[model samples]
Target: MSAGRHGRHEPVYRALELIANGLVRAQRLDLHVTGLENIPDTGGAVLCVNHTGYVDFLPLALGVQRAGRRTRFLIKSEVMDIGIMRFLVNHTRTVPVDRSRGAEAYRAALGRLREGYIVAVYPEATISRSFELKEFKSGAVRMAAEAGVPIIPAIVWGAHRQWTKGGARNMGRSRLPVHVRYGLPFTPGPDESPERETLRLRETMNSMLLEVQDSYGPHPPGEFWVPSRLGGAAPTPQEAAVIEADEALRKAEARAKRAADRARSRGSRR
Candidate 1:
């Protein structure tokens, strides 16, 4: 995989991305990635992806990983307080902001990007019900403008299908083909407010999404797509090794802890 814009050559991003990517692969789900050639080879960048359902985040995450950039995401505050999710997200360096606290969240998002992390901000801000794109928000625009980083518009369609409005309860079906589209990097003029700038960026991103849809044509009742040829390099050794080691270590640690608990139980019986 190519190094991200920051020139840090991160394996952590690669590892985390690899683990999540299995979700895409094991299902035999194919990704149609377009404009990937447009992703900058090097510094901090903003990725604004379409939000649909819960699965939407994972597909987008995996897609970003495929692009070779580890993105720090702006996550909901409530999600941060959950048991293991907090640990996982924090470990990945995701920044969580309380939806209730608007100003603070905005500042924090920009601050993290300024700190040189490629942050993913959802311009839709919240989930949408519309089939087409909805009104765009400016959180992303403002952050990029303030941080002075280029912004990349991304759209992930078809994710809403597996768990459609009222579909099957189980996540069945393998190789659920998904589309991940990206647009060339662009920045808003410094004169605008974050909100205004965010909308401009969102509009451009929406265009990219629309373009992809046009190229692939309207998806079936539940689908989205990319025009990319279903081909790319094989998963690198570093990616595979990290994934194996992390899973093994997690299992070993869990087993050790379980053994300790059993010993405690036996001693307590005494």
Candidate 2:
């Protein structure tokens, strides 16, 4: 679908936006948004964002809203399983991807795109504990290709300072500055491989992220929010990979223990 063809925004989404804006104001966040014009006024587009922190989506969505477009984010099914989150996601029309059944979510996102809704996806798939760009997944490029929509590269910087993994949370009125930038949209060629397109998209967003960081000012030495290369104490990407791997192993073990306990309980009952 072309630009300027989408339907009106849902009432719940509008209401949530108001609450979110109020929260932003309450926290006195110093938000800097640029290149919003790159977001199509009204059209189906895949917004590929680099994830740095838990609240990265908020600032990025605010920037897109400034462009007069509401974004439907592709969220994980685990988050959707939460009672409150489930209600919010359902009411706001967000698409949920079950990792075990990813195709279902892909179809849902594609349908939304074809219906002319801007779909935001984090190609990194998770928050970067290292505060650096993680490797990109080809799903965003593949979705854009199938949906015939442009891929909009976006970057969010400085959000990790507020709240991040293994870091102290400061959701209070700290007056933190978060920067959001939107790069020009581009569509992959029909013959281009998804892997190649995904790599190019990552490179583009990485460059944009560096630019945002540069303009965002100097990083405090040994701070947890900045990447090690930039002089802060955040772990290097390689170290972060190990940490994430350990985390995954722990989660798997916990799940197995739970399953075994459930089985034993059932046997005792029998």
The candidate that wins on lDDT is 2
TM-scores of the models, in the order given: 0.71, 0.95
Candidate 1 structure quality by residue, lDDT tens digits, 197-250 = 766776776677677666654444322221112221222335434554676699
Candidate 1 lDDT (Cα, 0 to 1): 0.66
Write down the RMSD of all candidates, one decimal each. Answer: 13.0, 2.0
Over the stretch 184-258, how does candidate 2's per-residue lDDT look in tens digits?
999988998999999999899989988999999879899898898988899999999999999989989999999
Which pairs clash (backbone N, Cα, C closer than 3 Å) in model 2? none
lDDT of 1 at 146: 74
Tell me the lDDT of model 1 at 94: 77
Sequence-dependent TM-score of model 2: 0.95
